[model samples]
Target: MELLQPGESQATRLHTPKGDVEGVVTCVTPWHFRISVPEDKAALAATWLRDLSDGYVAFDPDPLRRLPGPIVVSDSEAQPVTQATGVPESHLKPYYIGIGSTTDLEPLPAFTWEEREPEQLRRTPLFETHRQMGAKMIPFAGWEMPVWYTSVTEEHLATRQAAGLFDVAHMGVYQAEGPDAGVFLDSVCGNDISALAVGESCYTHFLDPDANVIDDTIVYRRDQDKYLIVVNAANDDKDWAWLNAVRDGKVRIDSQRPWARAFGRRVILRNLRDPKEGPDMRVDIALQGPKSRDILLALGCDAETRKRVLALKRTELCEATIGGFDLVVSRTGYTGEKMAFELFVHPERAVDLWNALLKVGEPMGLKPCGLGARDSLRTEAGLPLYGHELAGPFNLGVGEAGFGSFVKTYKPWFIGREAFLAREKQRQTVVVRFRFTEKGVRMAHLGDPVLDRKGRTIGFVTSCAIDSEGFLTGQAWVDLKYAEEGTPLYIFQGKPQSLGKSPAELKTGDRLLLPTPAVVLSRFPR
Candidate 1:
C-alpha cells in the first residue's frame, strides 16, 4: 500500500487463512503490492483466490503465481505470511501486482505523474525500415518502437553537429478540412484554430475536466479552413475520441494513411500486411542540422528548388522528384537546428531516398540516428515528450508557465475547459529536472521529493537524470514557494521513510543529492 523500497515487516491479523502466516512486503515504482502465502498452501490459495477480483494473490514454489483475493492493507498496517504457514520474506520474490487509485492510499502531500502508453501499439508504416537499420525496439505508446539505434549521446550529438533520421511515422496525422474545419478545430482543441494562417503550425493541448493534460499536438494550417493535427501516437485514440465526441462542425475527420498516392489506385485496407497491396504511400525522411541546407544544395537540386527546400525561416511546402519518386517537402526539423526538411516520397522508393540522403550527408558526419538520440536532443531543447511531459487531465492556463500563454486562447474544447479555467487561478507551476549523481547514474521518473540544504521540507524531486556529459539533471513541479531560481534542492537516492516523527536527515552529496546547476531553467523551460 506504500511506495517504499523492498523490505520485510511483521504483521498480526485477527483471522488467519493459513494459521500464523508471516510474509514480507516489497516496493516497486508507483503503488503496487503482492502477497506470498506459504508454499505448502500456495496452490490452494491460487485456486481459491483465482476468481477473486478485489486483488490478485498467487503462490509459486519455484515461480511466482497470482492468487485470487483483493488483499486490502494500509501504509501503517502490515500483513505477513510466516515460514510455517507460508513463505518467508526472502523466499517470496516480488513481482508486478496492479495499479492503486488515489483513494486507495494516504494522499501524499504530493502526487505522482504518469503518461498513457501509445495505443494500437502497431508498427509504423516504416517498421521494417527501422528494423533494417538495427533500431533497439521497445514498447512506447502501445507501439513497438525504436528507443535508439546507437547510444543516445552519439545520436544526440550527431543531430546537433550533423544530420540524423527518425521514423516519426508513428506520430498520428489527422486531417480536418472543409468549410467548418477551422470552427470544428476551435471547438475541439485547446487553441484558437481561427488564427492559423496558411502554412503555419501551432502547439496546443487537450485537457480533461480535472485539468489533467490529455495530449499535446502540433496543428498545421494546411490551407484555408483546412488543418492537419499531428498528435502523439499514444493519444491517437483519446484525441480522436475527444474530437469526435465534441466536434460540431461539418468538417470531415480523417486519419490519413501515410504515403497515400494522389493518383494511385485507391483501396481501403485494415493493415499493411494484407496480401492485396495497392500503390504504397510516400516515404518521409527528415534532413536536419546546420549543414543541412548545404548538403541539399550539393545533392544536385536546382537553385530555386534548394531555396524552396532549404529555407528554414518558415515551413514551406514544395514539390520535387527524388529517385523517380514524387516528393512533398517541408522545411522543418525537431532539434531546433538550422535548415531542415522532411521529404515525403513513394514507399517503393523509400530505400533509395534514405540511401541518397545518407550518401549526401555522410561527408558531414550525418548519421542514421534512432529514437534515443531524438529523445535526448528534444528533452535538452525543453521540447515536451508526448507521453512523459504532456498527457494528463490537468488545466492548461494555470498548470505550466509560458505553456498557456503560447496556447491560442480558443481551441477545440476538450474535457477540462470549464473546470480548468475555474481552477487556473489557484494552481502552482513547477518544472521537473532529471539530474545525475556522482556514480554517473542518470535520474529518471517522478514523485521524488526535493529537500533544501537544511533538509527542510521545501519541495520534491519529480524527475532526474545524467546527461551525455555526466552532468546530473532533473525536473519537478514543486511548491511555488520553493520554485524560485537559485533555490537549493537535494534529490535522494532512497525512498523517504516517515519515522512517524520527522524525516531522516542524510548527507546530500552521499545520497546523490547535489546543488542544481545554474542553467537548470535553460534545459527545462516553462
Candidate 2:
C-alpha cells in the first residue's frame, strides 16, 4: 500500500478463507490505507482487521466482482470468519463502490476540553422576602434559597393542612418554537411529545443512544408551533446541549441559567435564553396545599384570571393575571398534593405577589416554605430525586419516573428507540416503594441497601420518608427474583462489597450488610 498514492481509488476484497469482505481504499499512508466501507459494514471490517494476525488483500477492479470472488478454502487450524461467526454463508455478501463513488468516513473530533471555574451562586427575586420571614437560606442547585422558614416539619404539615409558598425561580425554563417543533421533539425525546394538546403538559425522559435517561423533564405545549421544556436547575447546561445535539439541526438553540423577578402565580415566559449566563426574566412560585385553590381565587387578579386558574386540570396550563401581572399558571407540583399550582412571574414583581399571597393566605395558615420541606414532601409521594433514586444506565444519573408506558414505541426513529425496543422483551426491573412495619420516623439514607432473607443484596433505597401516620416509606429498584409484592426484605447499614453495577444495579456501597427487617411495597406507589 506504500506505493499507492492518495486519491488513487482501488476496490479491494480480502479473502483469507474469512469469507469475502470489500472496501474502497481512498487514501494510502506509509503504514496503512484508509478504507471506506458501507457504514453498516464498517463495524464488521474494523472488527475483522483487529483479529487478523496474517491476511492477504485481493484487488478486484471488475464491475462484475461478486461474493465468493476468490474463496480459497482453508484446511488450516484458523477458521474463516464465516466459520468463526458460526453463521451460514447466506449472510455473507460482497461490497461494491459505484464508479466515482464519494464518501466521508473521517474520524470525529476528539473529546472537548473545558477549563474549570468556580460557579457564582445566584439569588431569587424573593431573596429579601425570605430573609424577612426568617427563612434559612442555603446553597441549593447553585442558588441561595430557603430550606425552611421555621422547621421542615411545620412547613410539611402546613402544605398538607392549608397552603405554603415556595420560591422556585432557579429551575431552568427553555423554549423550542418552529414549524417542525413536534417532529423535532418526537425524534429526540422519549415518551409522547405530540400526544399533548395545547395547554397540556406531560412528564418525559431525555435519553442517550443506549436508552439511558439524560434527564426527566416536563414538556408543555403552549401552541401549535411553540413548546416549553422545564428542566432541573442543575441540569440546565447539560440538558440544553443534549437537546441541541439531537434536534438533527432542525433549529438552533441558545440558553443560559434562568432567574426571575416577581413571585406570581404563573410564569409568563419571555425569551429565556442568552449567549452569556445572565438573569432570566421568568420566575416561578409554587402555591400548594388543600386550600391553595381558594387562596389563589382570593387574589386580587381579574375575574377571568381567577376563572382560568380554577378551570385548569392536572398538568394543565393557562394564561392568568395575578395582582395584575400577566403570566402563565400551571396546575403542577412535585409534592403529591391536591390543588397545587406553580406560578411563573417576572423577577421584579415577585416580591409584591409573594407578599400578597402571604397576606391573603394568613387566614388559611399559609406560610412561605423552603427546600427542606420540598424534599420531604416529594419523598413522601414516592418521587425520585436526581443523584439519589433516578439514574439511567450510562450517564450514571437520571431516573425513570416509572416504566414502559411512558416510552413510546411507535416512533420509527429516535435517539434511543432501537435500544428501548430491544429492552421491551426483557423482564423489566423497576423501582418500588417499601416501608418498615414498625411505626417510626427514622428513614434510610440514599446509599442504604435492601436485602433478602439470606442477606443477599437485592436493591438499595433511592428515596425515603416517614409520613404523618408514622409510616416509613421509600423507593428502590429490585431484581425480578425478589421483587414480588409481598417479598420480605431487610435494610442494611451499607452496600455489599461484592455488589457490582450490573443490569439490576444491585451493588451500591462498601459497608457492612447488617439487617433491619422491612417489607416491599408496591412496585409503583398508588
Candidate 3:
C-alpha cells in the first residue's frame, strides 16, 4: 500500500477476489500512477481493480498514454468518488487503490500460482512487414519471429544458389569503450581480443571460470578503444550480466591474468540495442549467399564507399553510408558463405533497409528468409548453435564442438583457459556432423541415440535438418572412438506411427522402428 513518489517505479502485486495479479507500478506524477500488467489479462485486471477499489478509481483513456502492454492510469486526487463520468463499460480503465499502507497490512503467505500466464512475446521492427508478407510466425527466443516466408527447402536453396536476406534485428548488440576495453575483453573472452586490429572482427566464446560456454559471440574492433559485440539473442541478458560482473570485478580472475586483476580499470559497457543510449543504437540485418556482395553493391553507395565495401574481406568491417543510412557493414555471418555480410543499422531504419535490399535484390533471386531456413543453412554449413553444439543439455565447449583453434591458448590468461585446456586433454566425446545416406526419414532430434552397426549406443544427436540436397544432415556428440570421418552409424528414431505397442510396453533392445543409416563426415558438404 506504499505510494511511490513521482518518477519512481516498484515491483508490486495486487490481491483480488479472483486471485493475485503481479506487475510493476510506476508513479508518473505526484497525483497520477500507472499500473502495467500482462497484455492478455488486461481486461480481467481492470474489472478486478474496479471491484477492489469500490468504484473509487477512475480509468484514463488518453491515447498518448498507451504503451505496448495494457496500462491503467488512476487519478489519486479523484479518490472517494462513487462514479466516473464518460467511462466506457467495454474499455474500463485500470487503476489500483490500496486500503492501507504496507506497514499496517498483515504479512502474506508465499504461494505459487497454479496457472501462470506466459511472458509476452516481443516483436521485431519488421513484425508487421512479415505479417503483411504472409510469413508464418512462431515464438523463437522470446520473440515472435517469422519461421519462413515460403517452404524451408525453397528458401534454403535460394540462399545457397543466389542470396537470402534475414531480419536478425532480434540479435543482441553491445558496445565496450575506453582505454582498457580491449584488456577487459581479452581477460573474459576465450580468444585474444587485443590481437584484433581496427576494422577486424573475430569469432569467440564467453567462458565461465569452469570452462563452460556462456555464449558464442563476434567482437568487432570499431576503433582503437571501441569494440562491438554481437551475441545470441537468447543469451543477451545473461551475457550482459556476465560482462558487467567481470568489468566490476565481481567475478574472480586468476592472478596469471594480471590485466584482469585491475578491477577498477576505466571501461564502459553499453547496450547498443537500448534507445536510451542515443546514437549507439543498432540492429542487425544479414545478407548471406554467393551473390550477397552483389546485392550490397546494388544498394547505391558512392564510389569510395563501394570500393571500401567491396574490398572488405572476411572478419573485416567498416562504417559506410548506403541508401542514406549509416551502417556498420561486416563481411561476417552465421551462414558459412565466404561473401556474406552483416549490416548493423539504426533501429529506425531497419525496415527501410530491409525493403530496399529486397527490392533491389529480388530480380537476382534474393529472397527474404526466416528462422527455419537460417537454421537449416547453418546446420548444412556445420556452424555451431549455442544450445545444441556448444552448451545446453550436452554441456559441450568450443573444443568439444571442434573449434578449439579459435581459443588463444597462448594468451597466458582468460576466464576458463586452464579449465578448457584440462577438459580438452581429458575429452571422451566430440561433436561431429553426419549425413543420412538415404531419404524419406524423419529428422533426427536432440538426445536421439546414435548407434553403431552392432546396435551399441555410440552418441546422441544435438541438432538435425533437411539439407537443400534432400538429405538429413545433423550434428551429434558421440564417443571419441566413433568420431572419425566416414564412420558408419545409425540413429535410433522413436517408434513409428503405425506401431501398436504403447511406449511403456516397449522393451529394451526391441525394435520399434528402423534405424536410419548415416555417415560421419569430417565436415558438411556446403
Q: lDDT values of the candidates?
A: 0.52, 0.63, 0.78
Which should have the higher TM-score, number 1 or number 2?
2
Q: How well does candidate 3 match the true structure in TM-score terms?
A: 0.74
RMSD of each: 23.4, 16.7, 20.1
Please, what are the lDDT tens digits per residue for candidate 3 over residues 1-526? 1235677776656555555566666766643566666655566677766543454333322211111112353433222212222322211111223222123222222111132233898888999999999999999888899999998999999999999999999999999997668867876788878779899999999887678888999999999889999999888877887788666655444423222332224578999999898887999999999999898889898999999998899999999998888999999998788889999999899999999999999999999999999999999889999999999797988888988889987554567877887888898888899999998888788888899999898888988988888998999999988988999999976523553466888888765566889999876553
Model 1: which ten-residue window has the lowest total lDDT? 260-269
| Residue 339, candidate 2: C-alpha displacement in angstroms | 1.8
Candidate 2 per-residue lDDT, tens place, 2-49, comes to 224555655565442345566555443322346655555655666555
**Model 2 segments beyond 4 Å from truth?**
1-117, 248-280, 392-401, 494-514, 523-525
Pick by lDDT: 1 or 3, better one: 3
lDDT of 1 by residue, 318-420 (tens): 5665434566666765666646666655556666667777787789888777666666666565555543444422222335533666443322133345455
* TM-score of candidate 1 on Cα atoms, chains taken together: 0.62
Candidates sorted on lDDT, descending: 3, 2, 1
Clash totals in order:
73, 15, 0
